[model samples]
Target: MTAPATKPQAAPAALALADDALVLAQRLGEWAGHAPVLEEDVALANIALDLLGQARVLYTLLGDEDELAYLREERAFRNAQLVEQPNGDFAHTIARQLYFSTYHHLLHTQLATTPAPDAATEDTTAPDIRALAAKAAKETAYHREHAELWTLRLGDGTPESHHRMQRAIDTLWRYTGELFQDLDGLQLDLHTLESNWHTAITDTLTQATLTVPESPRTSAWTAGAGRQGLHTETFGRMLAEMQHLHRSHPGASW
Candidate 1:
């Protein structure tokens, strides 16, 4: 009798997660010396380092961490569009962080509680993913808190600050739907994840005294496609800058 076919491993999910962390780390790192205040520079840098560490673990699972992060072409990355967005103003950055870190924290929490994969019957990557999620959930809790506090401070601040915060929320609202997309390989239910995300975001926004933007109309264009490796126009420029050092130095490393 012919042997049963071996199911392919779920590399896409891992790659997507890795790319999200890696790209966001790079974006956040851009604010290292440029943050609005000295304390924020340190805070943002710490967050970036945490994300970079997560990316390294995820990338190591796939193969060479450096190659996967530095050598990938524009069409090869699988990060969400939200993370790759330009950090506009302080409010804009905080808004993006609030949305993503909340989602991340919730997702990791769920994953940590998920039943372990059957070693004999399922992909081995499941155990690794769960382990990673457990650790990451802790870190993301801090991230979520940081973003939430800032959201409140900016949203309920002076009139000008409030206006900027509200505008930031509205601008980034369109990109958010992409985070809830149902990908093929993830074990978690995307619909459930999205529901939790919405509830959490709504509650936080309400507390911040900020208006949550109306959901996009069915006919309106939503930004996604990153899971399928497509990215925004600005992503190319970001990629160029990120890869420059590695490309220029070749195999050199400190």
Candidate 2:
């Protein structure tokens, strides 16, 4: 896609941002035929494709097309710990989609305005970035809706489903903070982004009768350095599988 970094904003620091998208896409693909309902199965598969498409375009922005897709080593990968976390159950997968998509909507929107919200209409790239942002915004809206509907349905339905949903929230909830984390040269205004995200996520959860992870707990949660190429144990396993073919026969291409 050859995404250009906005004039006032620099390009992403690592291909790892794109790596996060790619890994989540792959993990979601695992549920293609196993969702509890037909509509859900279709929805999840489509979301997986959407994430994969974004990843492909983002990777192209970072470097050599073929190499970026498959040539990276495990220690070189840059996806967040949340995306790489195993899809433990149906509840877990749904929670994953919900949380990530909501964050995407907020992050992309904020990035779109980074060039100065007033300058947005005057800049030529603004039109293009705005369109891209609009598309992603719509997709994320649907993703959040689908995920929350599923969460509520499951959480409010049976006793077993309710328990599972809460457990999913507890385990997966901690990983949410890393999404809004801003680092040096990240091209994001961390404080502003964090405030906006807190508002958006809390409002969304409130409607679903869910609580945001308390700040103290989130504070105590360990931060994984996915952005810096540090990864959890399973992440290496995933990278190994994804990179195996390209590594075994470097420079051999179709």
| Top candidate, metric lDDT | 1
TM-score of each: 0.92, 0.80
Question: If candidate 2 were superposed on the true structure by all CA atoms, what would the RMSD be?
Answer: 4.2
CA shift of 86, model 1, Å: 0.3
Point out where model 2 deviates above 4 Å. Answer: 1-9, 113-131, 183-186, 215-224, 245-254
Expressed as tens digits, the lDDT of each residue in 1-254 for candidate 2 is 45456432323333555677788887877777888888878888888787787676556555565677687676677677788988889988877877787777776666665664555324433344444555666776677778778877876768787777767877777777777665323455777767776686666566656656664324353555666666777877776777787788888768
lDDT by residue for model 1 over 1-254, one digit each (tens)? 12115433756777888899989999999998899999999998999999999888877777878899889899999998889999999999999999899989988898898786566544756567678999999999999999999999999899998999999999888778878765445577677888899899899899989998896711155344788787888999999999999999988878
Cα lDDT, all candidates: 0.85, 0.68
TM-score of 1: 0.92
Q: What RMSD, rounded to one decimal, does every model reach?
A: 4.1, 4.2
Query: Which lDDT value does model 2 have at 244?
Result: 84
Superposed Cα deviation of residue 14, candidate 1 (Å): 0.6
Candidate 2: residue 231 lDDT (0-100): 70
